[model samples]
Target chain A: MIAYRPREVIIEAESWKDPATAGILRNLPGIPRRTVADAGRISASRDTLILARYRGKFLKQCQGSGAEMCCNYFTASYAWNCHFECTYCVLQSYLSGSAIVICTNIEDFLEEIGRTLGRNPDRFFRIGTGELADSLALDPITGYSRRVVPFFASLPNGILELKTKSDQVANLEGLGHGGRTVVSWSMNSRRIRRSEEGGSSTLEERLAAADRCRRWGYRLGFHFDPIVHYDGWEEEYRDVVRQIFSVVDPGDVAWISLGALRFTPHLRERLIERHPGSRLPWGEFVPGHHGKLRYFRLVREEIYRKMNAWISDCAPGVEVYLCMESRLVWERSLGVAVRDAGHLSDRLDAAATGGA
Target chain B: MNITDMPIRDIDTANEECRISGELEAPALVRSLRDIGQLNPVVLLERGGRRIIVCGFRRIHAARTLGRESVPARVLGPADFSPLHPLEFALRDNLAFRPLEPLERARALDKLEEAGLLPETIVRVYLPLLGLPPRADILESQLLVARARPGLHHCLAGGILTQQSVEALARMPPESQDRFALLMERIRLSASLQRQVLGLLRDLAAGDGASWGAPLDGEEVGAILDDPSLSPAAKGEGLHEALYRRRHPRLTRARARFRERERALGLPGAIRLAAHPYFETADIRVEFSAPDAARFRFLAGELERAARGADLETLFEVDE
Candidate 1:
């Protein structure tokens, strides 16, 4: 695991007064701390941490472009940015500031989730905490999962997916998740993990952790998202798929998602500026719906077709879906298309609930 | 610090020291000279017992055009001036008045480096003063354009060649740059087309392991360029299409296969079958225009029938 040491911690005056903030501060004993009147005053830097209260709705729908097929998944805004620097990370463009903002008002966040789940008891809600941040990269420091996992376990129809690229699952062990919380890893080929996913866990470490999660009675998920197209990608990805089945049983895996490398046009310039000498932006791209740049249709279809074939060959019974893809792409790649977001939600719910 | 009126004939107008070119007379400045007289005095340096013009070449020419026997001048001793001092004065004075053309900017940069100024110092201090980016790459690109063949420099000054296009051309051999510049000038290619052609040439050269001129000398390229009946635009379009085919042979075959499959489908002219670019996508888009409900219903029925045809799958089949 990559050790994360913030240069300094800037706490909001109100947040510093919270008891939870006091406990979090005690975890990082030697880090310098200063109290700020508001989180806005603290400039975000990669090495700085800002503990502030989150005032917005904690549960938000994933802002998928309506033009594409959406999985109808929701996200909980527990944190604002990630510490790991993936070369094509959208956070580099989405977040104006760099400071890792961890909302210290856990009570308020959990209360909102409880109220939301209570209001929709009959609705199957699949919410993830890794949209804006790595769900578990900083969990060891904050131990927020201990609070979130149990609350989700009590929900009648909601499932919490703690997606991460780190092996910080020891805290998650022994928690009474009741098989409601899913531990997912944002995985890539070993070659990609070493070169592109900087400061993230190795493929072996992540698989080992997945095995641990399986043993702990939690469902498992894997995301092959932002899959880069490079030379010899077929062999590399085939090796990764082979390794995944060898490490864990196919029956334990809930679902796997495939998404190609795509980004907004605004992120193009930022990628070049932030990661000079990066070949990620050199591929041929066309302007897609919602202003995102996507690989040529043929290129994306070929990749998906190959990946789906390889994964199905290994784990024939496991569910594989496309994330934020068009209906045509879904039909061409997976041989089936959910009617809409609601239908997609139903399919995923079945998979997560072991009904698939 | 002597200010006196010097006869226009006595001033060395043919001095090889001056780097500024093009029309020396500006109508506004000439109008000012004709109306209010010379507002600023021209600087001169006494060299070889003759006064060489240091700055204000335009003002002197305007004064001469206005039938003035003499113009206000400031004479400085040669002892205080170095060889580059006059060029420096000319550059700074012109920069204060207006933005310099690309060639003029290139010449100023060249003179600065020749005068013992480091490229780093030029990029930091002088580039911004000239309204250019303070980057070493920009400095180097400008220097390359400045040092290119005279025809290429003329094209740069004429705004026929963009900085990006010139930079790309600069990477080629001098002979190739000259040939491409001539071709571009003949075809009157827009800045965007210039870039595309240069990119195609570079890719073709790299793929073929030949010189840049080899692609230009191809039979298809020569035929397109020599087609006298075709308009320049038509020739340009034809050349780009041909070069694109050469550069992406696989994509060309895929496109040809798609066209053939689309043709075999025998859909109405109003109905268009389009595939994702490079066949990188399996999605085929069918578009048609319907003027009324009946037509719309008919088109929908036709599309439904076409979807059931076996040839529809061929449209999505690509080599990848």
Candidate 2:
């Protein structure tokens, strides 16, 4: 009954001092204090709060463990903290503190990325900043995405994705980013965005922002993650499809990801404690191969059928893919289970090269 | 015929052996035998005194339908084969199938255990198709056999509870499940009892209806469910009975005002029934006409309030 405010949030990280992290820092725009340092080649910002600088080095060292390519398509932004309080968020578990973070080591970071890209000169490298922090959420205060867009525009074999739940696209207007960059928004049905996501843009705001990106010649993508299964989900999702069609043409969309509600068992308690009266039970589930709770095959197939069918009707011919789905599911539900599915790199490569 | 290479004898046949003619049969049995083959064999014991079947009752029936002379038989103690322990052997044989029906499997396990087979061996040698790992498989199977044999069958066939529901049930302590079962039984026994149980469970499950978001105490809930009202509709009527109508006059007036606004807006009356307060923001306006945009904003605002208010503690009913 009382107005709520968060208190004592935990932030966490492992292997935080990554070279790829520097590229994220160098490309960040609108940071209060920004300088291209040559000594140590690491840019430092005094205006921002530095919570922690992780020195550990390891690959794909986080929860939701999987093979390299799928997990590491984008390097860690080293920036953490999300303003939108989505109930089923990994960052809530991953972070050790609640304070906003700004990593300041761009010069060396970009240089390291340059070196890595140079070694594999013929191959394209896809990196993203949205993993640790919302890609565009902090753009107004931090201008991180704007900075990265230009750096990506100049690299021939590099692609950047700035994903967010925010409609803050004004930051992109001044940046002369070509089609080399992607501006993506995570979407859900109106009901979910209302019931689950807090401090995030509504679906219409997101789609409208996507339209703006397309007009600006930027590729757009959508992620329907943590797609909670409840009563009338089919009709609810179809309604979302109708909305998507009402806003933007399908041709401008690069990809769309459909992910079901999945999380560690421990979160069930957290969710029960946090979001009461939440009607999230679809009553069909099994422990997944990854050891997280997942929908039963039948329930999962039902979700896939409902979602894929809606996508086919509304955005025909657009690249529709599943996020972190198993092969058994891929074949039964979508009828497209490629071997390299569980890997994001494989999916990314397929997207880049236009492979189905 | 190198029958030693066979996985087992009579995978899809009855346990007891009997005489059968290939010419006579029922349509369902005929179909099963057609796919799986005749299972029961006539056992010939002790210097081959007489060819008689020790097991495979369904196979014998099917064989009689097909006019076949002999069916596959597992010879037992006559020295090596015995026909005296018909019921025990019948139970053991039925338990061998990977997809044994739940009721039959439970009854068989009960019989097998009484026949001196250790619980662990039955788990290893018997219950593989139950989809449980070796140790857990045994324990869950035994629990299934014990608590709700018929229900477990439906569950295993993926017919009753969804995987999601099972996961939820698995988290609860076994004693809690037992309590839930007892409660369900109480409701099922009588219509009057059912109404009382529904009201009690509803109130209990509502987690105090926005009152500090605490689940009702289990003892209090059980008492409410067990309480007998004057009539069947008595408990149901209590829900519509306004609480503190005289004391919270302003609360009632605000509700009436909201109802009038809702009617004017052409929204369903059901929206007013929510226990928690809800408000929607303007629907993230797309290119829309003024009227549609206004409606969208009103709906979105109401929805925004609902979303902001939802927290985990508010959703789940932790029965004390």
Q: Which of the numbered candidates is closest to the native, going by highest DockQ?
A: 1
In candidate 2, stretches whose alpha carbon ends up further than 4 angstroms from where it belongs are A1-72, A281-283, A341-347, A350-356, B1-320
After best superposition, candidate 1 residue A205: deviation in angstroms?
0.8
Please provide, for model 1 over A1-356, each residue's C-alpha lDDT reduced to its tens digit, 9 standing for 90 to 100. 68567989999988976677987888889899988888876666889989998887889888773756888888997788888888889888888888998899999988998898899888988999999899999998889999999989898888999999999998998999987898999989888788778899999999999999999988899999988876798999989989999998888888999988999978976776676556677554666767787776667777899999999999997988888788878887788867887788788899887883
lDDT of 1 by residue, B205-252 (tens): 754667877888889988988988888777877888888787656567
Worst 10 residues of 2 chain A by lDDT: A1-10
Please give, for residues A250-329, the per-residue lDDT of candidate 2 as tens digits. 87777787888887666654666677665552233445645676665456666887788889888888877776665555
Provide the TM-score, chain A, model 2. Answer: 0.79
DockQ of each: 0.23, 0.01
Best TM-score among the predictions, by candidate number? 1
Q: List per-candidate RMSD values in Å.
A: 6.3, 21.6
Docking quality class, candidate 2: incorrect
